[model samples]
Target: VWHKCVDIVTAGLKRVAEIGTMMPDPHGYRRYCFTPLVAWTADLPEQLMIACVSKSASPVTEATHKQFGDSHSHSSRTGDLTLQRIEQVARGTHPWNNLSRFQREAKTIQLSGVHLPFWRNWPFADPSIFLLPEILHTCHKFFFDHVLSWCRELLEDDLDARFKCHHKRVAVRHFAGGVSHIKQMTGREHRDIQRTIVPMIAGCVPPRFLRAIRAIISFIYQAQSPIHTDTSVKEMESSLQEFHAHKDAIIEANARKTRSAGTKNDFHIPKLELFHSFAAAIRNNSGLIQYTADVSERLLITHCKRPFERTNKNKD
Candidate 1:
């Protein structure tokens, strides 16, 4: 019988091999496998209350109406990126208008309105901390990066455009459907086009963690568990070497894009790229990167930039 370690290490060692290794399920919504570490979620900002006093705009308490009064800026270390963007998008408006609880006199004009649904619930867009265990578990369950790579292919191909367009159409349909429908047909309704386009997108392996339990189980099943030998150790070494190679390949691939597209990535796409790969391998082109992507004092400050007056009268 083959050794357990040898089996898994063998699978991992063959990075280019098609071993049907079950990696993590990116589609999982209920399982809280890996938790974001730095998230320290609870300590971050939750709600901001903008007291709308109609007494000719009297400044409220310092705790309430401070520098970030209208602007609900949270600790970046703990702030959710997506939430912050929504706050930004809501723009210079009252974020806490909906959750305000103030007792006003009969003459005070007081009512509440929320600029967006949640004050700052989307964290994926910001710097997120994911549990290594979860990533590992996922890698094992999904069997290397095959599933993830497949998803990325779809995204770069039919899935990304189709999903984006479909979502856009759906959104427009809710308020202005007829206009978008007239523009083009939805992606799903046309199978021939989708099949033709899928092959063109890039592909990658799903993320990995060598010792993921599910992966361990499958590898063990393929061989003899609770067993180890010199061969197993050698196999593991080979796997690690291949791991480094694949990592370099992925970096090189993404790096090419950066060089080609002069615009620097304001946010990291590694995780999203991993998501793409996972979705693709499962042959499921439909996937979403549930994360945030905007948070910049520079950008925000720039948005507040005003025009400088030029005085060149006689020259022209």
Candidate 2:
């Protein structure tokens, strides 16, 4: 199924390439000569990865294969590399070479001719290039889930008890007890924090904490900007460096508070390393990375769900 899909897509691309070559523009500008490139973007979802790599063993698929399919599946095995091992193996370095062993092996996928890995070959550009760090998922995990959540924990009680609006004959209970006890904020709640709480607490929290928030938000906003250039990439790198420095300082100061507060949880934030990976993705192919964010997918899913809800098919 995977190879078939690849063949169909590649065949279409080949025809397009041929037509592009044959067609001539009046101004001698051949727009069709420009080949199309594509990348598949998704969070590291287990089942999706299994399907992409053809490791799933569902009975329906097995049954369909048994009756009519070729006896051999495409090179379906990687000696010892499993999906779960990728993050550990990659070590936040060259995502293509370090993450997928098979992708590294099939360094270049030709649009024409035989595929080295018969089963799963990329039809467009190299799979390594196609794999991108989704900003919506990755940034949210780092900035909101990890960084903001930790900040909330450390500041919530204090903010609730002490921080007040400027015109403070009245107590501002916007965050009465700080956000520490609350679970990770929802997307809407996170926005509310940015809109309402960020300015409110700017003077209250350490300058470094505010700087970190601003830095992360700046990177995210810059990434979403329509403008693309080397300068944007450099800007993101600079933002990341600023974020890292401020993050380390905040963590160091919080270390003592965590120790004294009798909390068993460490101040460590998960997937902070992915910022480097995300930046690398941008460095490798900024144009492609721009399109890989999860914003479109989330919107598409919401659009698709509405019809199901209207038909009462989505009722729980």
Candidate 3:
């Protein structure tokens, strides 16, 4: 059903890409306009859906759950490669002739069995290139979901207590009741927590664990910077390397756990692997800040939420 919907919506996009469109400029001169999908602003899960990859696979890279924690970036997965895989499955050569065999092949390659994706025929658009990094979900949510959990495991109550005791300042958020008590957390709250988290956990955790936290926080801030240079991007890369080097401390402390079993320590986080692609994304699509979801989030409130709230509760 979702794929059908996508095909319906993207039919026009595919047409536009194939033949281009005609539009008038501000001066009223008609010009040929080539509309290609340059960027797709979505969180990781949605990105997986659009890219037609499995949940455990990365949309941009070849990294799967097993290789997610690798310090270096993996080879990117291009639209051509994805389409080729789909074609292979469709062909159903000797081993993959049967349904079970086909399913197994698709699973092995992490294809979602989406024989025809929305962007399959779109011009000048590659999911690996255009499915850009979003700071709001990728960075802030990752900190709150993964890093904060590890901190809580190590520091326990002391982590929250430290947040409670931290001195307040003008224009800075002070967690008077600590973060744990907060029933809901927004991106703003996530930023506030990240702003003070490194210092708050200082001297409380092991040296490697503290270093890991510091490095990731640094990477997030650097990635969010409004402007970027070659040097700045390199610095971001260095910060990620530092974090990966020290991340074992979290596993050693039993802070990181397997999501499925929860019995064993693990570092196979997809978001962490997503970090490796940011530098390339910046080069390909300019600064990461340009693709942030903050603006869209604000628009959602103004355009969707307020309008819906004014409607009657009974499906108005």
How does each model score on lDDT? Answer: 0.27, 0.48, 0.87
- TM-score sort, best first: 3, 2, 1
Model 2 lDDT on a 0 to 1 scale: 0.48
Task: Give lDDT tens digits, candidate 2, residues 50-169.
Answer: 233332221112211122122221232231222223323344444444435434432222111112222133234433344465655656545556556545555665554443333334
Candidate 3 yields a Cα-based lDDT of 0.87
- Minimum summed lDDT over a 10-residue window in model 3 is located at 93-102
On TM-score, who's better, 1 or 2?
Answer: 2
Tens digits of lDDT, candidate 1, 1-316: 1223333544433432322334456775443232212221111111112121122221121111122212111222222433343344344444344223222221132112323322122223122222111222222222222322323432344434443344333212221221113223332222222222223232322343222212322321222222345565345334333443343333333421333454322223222112212211122111111111112323443553322123333444
TM-score of 3: 0.91
lDDT, residue 277, candidate 3: 97
CA deviation > 4 Å runs, candidate 2: 1-36, 46-120, 159-192, 195-198, 253-271, 287-295, 312-316
In order of appearance, the predictions have TM-scores of 0.19, 0.54, 0.91
C-alpha lDDT of residue 190 in model 3: 94
lDDT for residue 101 in candidate 1, whole number 0-100: 28
**Winner on lDDT (1 vs 2):** 2
**Highest TM-score against the true fold, candidate:** 3
Evaluated with lDDT, which candidate comes out highest? Answer: 3
